[model samples]
Target: MDFDEYVAARGQALERFAYVLTGDAHRAQDLTQTALLKAYRHWRRVTAAEHPDAYVRRIVTRSYVDWRRRGSSREEPVDVVPDLPEEGASADPAERVAARDELRRALVTLSPKQRAVLVLRDYEGYDDAAIAATLDCAEASVRSHASRGLARLRAVLSEPTVPEELR
Candidate 1:
């Protein structure tokens, strides 16, 4: 596919992937835009690859990792937390949002590389080999990062919840 077609097809998916990586919708949008711009700038190089979408995603992931490492000194604290929307009520929206928030917090606890590996492996449903190819790391390293990342997530998620009576 041509660059335009690729962008139209993959933009939303790339946005969601960025959201999962950054855990903030605004930052996710920025990350997606940055990745797309970079891809567009090097469209020839990217489109020549066997899996161009994968290549762009790798760019997004690495860019995020690098930004995190370099921009740590300018971080700002969140002054307020937003409330969850009530759109999906099958499960309590509040609880679901809380769970999502916990997951986001757990994600921050991981190294950027580890977070990227988990997001690609579990959230994006890429296999270890695919992840290794995308991240340009060994498959075993993907496995190790995924393992450690998942253990951290479980630990963060399994902490005390509101009492059953409250729910």
Candidate 2:
């Protein structure tokens, strides 16, 4: 397919992949746009690849890693805290949001490579070989990153949260 067609079919998926990789919607958009621009510059070559989507995804992943390496992605803390759940709100949705927020927090604690490996392996359902190709790393390195990433997440999430009474 041509560049426009490829984007039309895959843009949202690419953006979602980037979001999972970066854990930020705005950064995901920037990463997706950067990758698409690169792909557009060499559309013929990209479309000729065996799996063009994978090619674009590799670009997004690399762009995120490069951006992080340059130290432009550091997050500064905000003085204002988020609103707590409403007193009468149902517990299930609030619990899910809390869990998701905790996961995002845990993800940010990981190194970029570890985050990428975890997202590509677990979130994207890619096998070791595909993750290796996407990250341009050895399969063993991919396995190592995934293991360490998961272990970190477990350590962070499994930490006990003090109850309101305790606090």
Score every model by TM-score.
0.75, 0.82
lDDT of 2 by residue, 36-146 (tens): 999999998898899999999989989988888888764542222333334554367976687667666767777889988888888889999999999899999999998
Poorly placed runs, candidate 1 (over 4 Å): 71-101, 158-167
| Residue 54 lDDT (model 2) | 91
lDDT, candidate 1, 11-54, per-residue tens: 99999998888877778888899999999999999989888988
Clash total of candidate 2 = 0
Question: Which residue pairs clash within candidate 1?
Answer: none
lDDT of 2 at 9: 98
CA lDDT, every prediction?
A: 0.78, 0.82
**Quick one: best TM-score, which candidate?**
2
Note the residue pairs that clash in candidate 2.
none
